[model samples]
Structures are given as C-alpha cells and as structure tokens.
Target: MKKKDKSHSHSHLAFDHVSFSYKHSDKFTSVFDNINLTIHEKEFVTILGPSGAGKSTFFRLASGLEQPESGHIRLRDKEERHRLGKIGYMPQQDLLLPWRTVLENGLLPLEIKGMNKKEAREKVLHHMKKFGLLGTEDHYPHQLSGGMRQRVSFLRAILGGNEILLLDEPFSALDSMTRYMMQEWLLEQWHEWDKTIIFITHDVEEAIFLSDRVLMLTHPPIKGEIDEVNVPISRPRNEEHRSDAAFMKLKQDLLKKMRSKERSL
Candidate 1:
C-alpha cells in the first residue's frame, strides 16, 4: 500500500521530542528517547508491535496518564502539561464496574464533569440505542456479554467529550467473530462521531482494516522516528475488502515485519 501523504493535514496531537523512563528497582529504564510523532485531525492511526514495545506507554504519555521526563506532548498544536480529562481512553479490559448498572457506568464521565444528574442520564439514554445498549441499561457488567460490556465501556469513553480517543486493544479479549463485528461497528461509530482515533492492536488485519495508517513501534528504549505504512484500502470498507489482493499482501508484509522484530528480542 502506498503511504498516504499527510503533509497538508492539521496536527491534532503530537509528541515533541518526548523522552520517558520507568523506575525499576534502583535504576531508570528508558521507554522512549527523544521520539516525535504527530497524529492528524480525524485520522485513525493504529500502533502495532510485540509485547513490551512501549505501545501502552505511548498511550499513557499521549493521554497524560504519565508525564514525559523531558519534551512536550501537544494537543491541537498546543502543549499542555496536564491532559487527562482532555482525551478519551479505553484500556484493554472493558473495566466496567461490576456493581454498576450499564447506565450508571456510562454516566461516569459526565458525573466527573459535574453535569446535572438528570441531564447526564438523559444524555446516556439518548445514545443507548445507537450503542446497542438500550434495554441493558439496568443490567450490571457481570450480566452482559463480553461484547456488550465493551459497548458500555466505549459509550463511557466518548461521553468524556474529547475529540481524540486512545484505544488500547479494546477487542483483544473477544471471540474472533465478535471481534470482527466490533471492528465494523467501530468504523461506523468513527464515521458518525468524527473523532481522531489512536488505536493499539496486535492484529495486523485489524490495524489495516481500521486505520488510515499503521505505526510500528520497535522494541523498548525506542528512539527517533517510528516506522509506518498507510492503509491503501478506501473508507466505508466491508467484509469483501478483506479478501482483496492488496489487503492480503499488506497483511503478509506487516506479519513479516512483526516476526522479525520479535525474533530480534
């Protein structure tokens, strides 16, 4: 697939020469070293790499869950020191509170923002049908299927009111068929919501199917620029696109790259 030219697009989020390290035992181990990355407005970008490749760390720094040891993280081209509530984040696990009803869980972000209880409930209810969570409002997380739980988690993330969403392998735990369905549903939601999505996934096909571009993070202690490939498949993609020649070729290429990196480790 040819790399898409993103030179003209507006930068929505950027990591400007950011450096970060983790404290382990008595020493600090580098995760990212003077790395810079820019995600354009409304673009869906996927990060793929082996385990411990700093993928989750990238999300943490981008979402401001963790601060860089040096350099700046910017959103909308403006550097902000504190950015937690400004971005929506969905972790690998659905992380829905087991005791909370679907409605209660979906209202968490609005609640945190001090929205009126009645207004927040109304807002959550309004999107219930669209999210395929209408009748499950009173059900606890434990009562819902894995896919249903994830839908609730997704609803909660968007209600955070952020235009940029960071999703860390959200479908990894689902069955294969369910995962595929969720990917399709996610694209529909992305189109309607018009938000920039930065997704992390171990699945090459998922990355190609869902992203405008796929970014590969080398092993930990990553430095300089990240390797990337633009997804050539056009938007509003369907299941038939998966069988296209370009899609198969790209999948093989990505798998080869990932395997080489894993072998190096």
Candidate 2:
C-alpha cells in the first residue's frame, strides 16, 4: 500500500461520523454507524466488498439519493443538505432511455439544467469523440453494444458538470475484453476531465487496476471504521503493470482479505 501523499491533502468529499439505516416491514436494519471517510480531489477510489456489504447503500448516501440519519456529508468541505443532482451518478445498468437516440440521451442532463437545445446539442457533440460516440449520434440504445451503451451513460453523467461522479459497477456487464478496454478508456476520460470518481465493484482485479485507493467494507452494518489500502503502482498504468510483482502481491492480499471477511460473515 502506498502512503497518503501530502500534496493531495484537500478532500473533495467526506462522510463525517455518519450513520444510516433502512426500515423494512416493521424492522429497522442499520447500515452505517458513525463512519468517517475522505476522498481526495480528482482521486480514483474503488469500494470492494462482498454482496450485502452496503456498497450500494454507500453510493446512495454519497449521491444524496438517501440521507444519513445522523452526522454529515460534505462536498468541497461544506455540508450539503440537498445533494441530489449536485453529483453525477452512473448505476450498474446503463439506464439509457431506449426511445432516445445516443445524442438525445447524452444531452439529458444539460437539457434538464434548462440549457438551450441548440447549445446542449453543441456541448454534447463537442464531447462525442472524446466519449467514443461521435458516429453513433442517431443510434438508439438497443443498436449499440454494451460498451457503447455504458459510454453513453457516462457521457450523460458527466454532462451534469459536477466535479465528483459516483459510478456503481458500470462495466460489470461487459465481456472480459470489452471490460478491460473500457477500463483503459475510463482512465483516459478521468485524466482528461479531472473528475473525482467513486466506483463500487466486487472484482478485486478491477479495483486494483483503476484505483489509487481500494476501500474494503468487510461486513455489513459497518461500525465506525473501514479498511483501506493504497495502490502503490505508478500512474499511466497499463496491461503490463497487472503482471508486476507488486500488483500480483496486492491482488493476492486483497483476495485473501475478502475471502476471510466472507467466511466471517
């Protein structure tokens, strides 16, 4: 694990002593208990855990889809009361409107913001090539491959013009080769856009490949603290780095930890 860099001191998002729970059928189930977490600006952070470990719940809280029962969620060092629409979010599924063309889907956020149709189209068009959707403007969701659909979904998320994005297993549905290619493409986009990304995934290798830090939520109903490891590998990582000795060791360690946590549950 790498040491925290002093240069990256400023946190773009933070959860301060936050607690949350859900009520179902006269039963209240707790998810978080006084948890504190900090994500730095422009950082690539991944949350890894077993199923039912509250990973989705974490994202929901971060994106403001659900609020904490106690404590605070801070954006840019200030607590934000209404966080919905303030942060971009891409769920596991593409969630694209099948009836809308690629161009129209990508323009949804900007349009919702009340930007003029002509200006929104211009803005989305300017980014089509960057998002690898230049020629598919008129294509519908069904006409595009899984990878392309994800790109369109991502484009829509970013069009919201937020500095932070919450991506929930966005590439988990793609084939292995396509998933790898999309991972590389995502890094390029992250570099170009300079956005802080909080990604959730069950794949250990995926977490190691894309994140500066991997946060592990071992068991459900988390209390006070969470485990984390910083990826020591250098930036501009590629396929070659996956085979590096450190990468392999880290992967093994993370897998071991995950397995142990699962067994404990």
Candidate 3:
C-alpha cells in the first residue's frame, strides 16, 4: 500500500478532446475519437481495458511515440505535442540488452544525454541499494529472475528524472507470485518517490490495489468514451484490503463495468 497526495487541485497531466488515428495501407484507424481526461499531481492512476482495446495506443500517445490527429495533451499546465523526452516510459518486457550488465543499462540514458557516466553510476548505485538491487549491478539480465529484470527496467525508467512515469503492463509477463511481489514493490517506490504514475493494465484487482482512480477506456476508435472509477479504499492499501468487504464490492463493480463495456464495444 502507498500513501497518496490528496492536495493536488488540478491535473498535472491532461488530454483535452484529443483524437488520434493510425494508417495501414489505404485505411485510417481511429484510436481515440476525442479523449478528455486529467490526472492529478503525484497520483497513481491506472487505465484499465480489455484485450485489443487500443490500450497501447494511449500509452504511445502519452509518451509521444505517436501524436493525435487533433486536440492536445498538457503536462503540468503547458501543451506539449512532442512529449518524447518529457516522460519516463516502461514497457512490459524488461527490454534490457543481453550483453549489458545491470549497471551499464542503468547508465544508458544519462550517457546518451552526454551526462557524466560516473555521476550517473553513483546515483543509480544509491537507488539500487534502496530498491534491493544493490548486489545485482554486475549481473546480466539473463542471470536475474523475471522480477529482478523488471526491477532493473523500472530503475532505468526512473533514472531519467521525469515527473511522470508511464508503465505499460509492467508486471504482466511475471508469474502470479512475482506479479504480486512487484505490485507491492511498485507501491513502495511510488510512495517513497512521490512521482505521478500512469499505469496500464487489464487486471481488475491490480488496478484496484495500485491506483487512486482507475480510468475505464472503451474499445478502439475511442470516441469520448471513458469512465472514471474511484478507489474508495484508504491508503496505503494492503493484503488485508484485498479480501475486505469494501474491496470485494469494488472489484465486483469493476468487473461488471468491464463486462458491460465489452458488450457495448
């Protein structure tokens, strides 16, 4: 469970009437017809949708890997169409280079920016120790467990010092036990760092456990179709919270919403 900052009066990130599309051959596929949403500062928000719901498209848009055909995305208070370097994004797989040791991989972003590699290592070492990855710096990705690899991946994403973190199904590839552990670890990091997080996942329980609010997105060619489900359970959420009466009720509601949304789609 993580403590949430409830003082943010306005959204640190926002999408206003945003519309995006993709082109394949001669066909244009709309991902978002008009998305309007806001995420408050230092809040942990998860976007939940079923399979093939254009979930990845939303992440691509937020990370500036792609752009909307119309409308705008705002960070803090400014419009930034090119959010490329402005966000920290972590894809599902660790994506660590097999040849690089964990330490080398952690230093990559700073190295690319012409930053002093030595300084970057020092900073990362401190965080590694804090993240329980202190002794693994010399290890290659293949040598570490799935959980460890994901931890290293998360460390890489955070090393860039972005205010917001965009995690795309970061724990999906892990075993159930590892996913649970990673979820707990992620909350610890979120609370400690106080960074705003936008996480995407299809798991109802995971969304309930990790987010301040879960945004329900409709099927692709999304057209102003979204729902915000509030997580009323108090922070920091815990194992006890999972089976509690209120939590179960919330989970059931989310399940219903998903099924209904699926039917509609």
Whole-model lDDT, candidate 1?
Answer: 0.88
TM-score of each: 0.90, 0.90, 0.89
Write model 3 residue lDDT over 1-265, tens digit each, in one string: 4545577556788889999889999998888888888888898999998776888888888888888888889988799978979899987766798999999998887787778878888988997986678899999999998778877888888888888999988877678987887788788878888889999998999999999899987678777847889898887766788899999999999999888877876
lDDT for 151 (candidate 2): 79
lDDT of 1 by residue, 1-265 (tens): 2233456879999998999999989999899999989899889999998788999999889888899999989999899878888899987678798889999999999999999999999999988877668999999999998778877887888899899999988888778987888899889888887888999998899999999999998698988887889888887888898999999999999888877866876
| Poorly placed runs, candidate 1 (over 4 Å) | 1-7
* Candidate 2 similarity to native, TM-score: 0.90
Q: What's the best-to-worst order under TM-score?
A: 1, 2, 3
What is the Å distance of residue 28 in model 3 from its true position?
1.9
- Candidate 2, pairs of clashing residues: none
Each prediction's Cα lDDT score? 0.88, 0.88, 0.85
Error of 1 at 116 (Å): 4.2
Task: Write down the TM-score for model 3.
Answer: 0.89
Error of 3 at 223 (Å): 1.4
Candidate 3: pairs in clash: 33-222
